[model samples]
Target: MLSAGPTPKVPLDSWEFVITTETGAEYRWSWSELMALPQETPRVDIHCVTRWSKLGTTWQGVSLDTLLDGIDTDAAYVLAHSYGGYTTNLPLDDLRGGRAWVAHTFEGGDLPAEHGGPARLLVPHLYFWKSAKWVRGLRLLSADQPGFWETAGYHDYGDPWREQRYQGD
Candidate 1:
């Protein structure tokens, strides 16, 4: 688990976890509420832009589809925000159809803060940076808005199989 910032501290109190949409609707769920949702344990292969790959890593989290279910929107992208002020953007499609989750567990245990505990956006199909550790919320967008890494010239869409690691790669 690598990041550009220190691990953020999770609040001990009950706070709302929100997902905002481009249409101005917000769905806020408590941590317990999220845990109550159907959980999935996906064995995914994670590739890092830095050249490290972890295969078949187990993660437990609520599927993005479940969270977004019945929420009406025409958005095509998502900006995932983390507690420590980190953010990443991805095509909303990459997060649907069992492709992503807001995971709170790893390897059948609580996910450590350094590993995006409490909850983190997990889009295993992309480079690990797109996972956005310490994730807190998501903001839907109609356009392809760039987040931290993309603003820094990293590939807007990070596909490991295509070896899309940098601006010109």
Candidate 2:
């Protein structure tokens, strides 16, 4: 498990997830509301930019597709924001079509805070850093915006398989 900062202990009652479109429209889901949404247990493989790979890990959460349903946006990119102020950007398309989820459980148990409990974005197809642990919201943007790691010289699009770990990799 890895995080850019200390774990945030979010109270379930105050925890909420929001989706902000480029037009500033906001859609929100509280903890109870989010738990009521359809949930799926995805068994996936995750690779980190630091050169470690974990296969067939199981996670439970609502799919990004489900959360994005009915959201009206013409944006081409998305910036995932976490509770601790960590952010990561990705093409909007990369988050749709069953590619991602906001997971709250891992290995059949509630995710530990050390592991981004409450919830975290799961984008297994990309390097684990793109997962944005402790995720709280996604901001839809019309243009590309580099997030924390990207701005620190990490590859803007970190794909472990392609060895896209550093800016010039």
lDDT of each: 0.88, 0.93
Question: Mind giving the per-residue lDDT tens digits that candidate 1 earns over 1-169?
Answer: 6888888879636545688999899998988788789989998998999999998899999999999998888999999988989889899999999999988899999888888887888898999999988888889999988889989999989999999888787
Worst 10 residues of 1 by lDDT: 9-18
For all predicted structures, in order, the TM-scores are 0.96, 0.98
Residue 158's lDDT within candidate 1 is: 94
- After TM-score superposition, what is the CA distance of residue 56 in candidate 1 from its true location, in Å? 1.2
True-structure RMSD for candidate 2: 0.8
Query: Largest TM-score belongs to which candidate?
Result: 2
Best by lDDT: 2
Task: Provide the lDDT at 114 for model 2.
Answer: 88
Q: What is candidate 1's local distance difference test score? A: 0.88
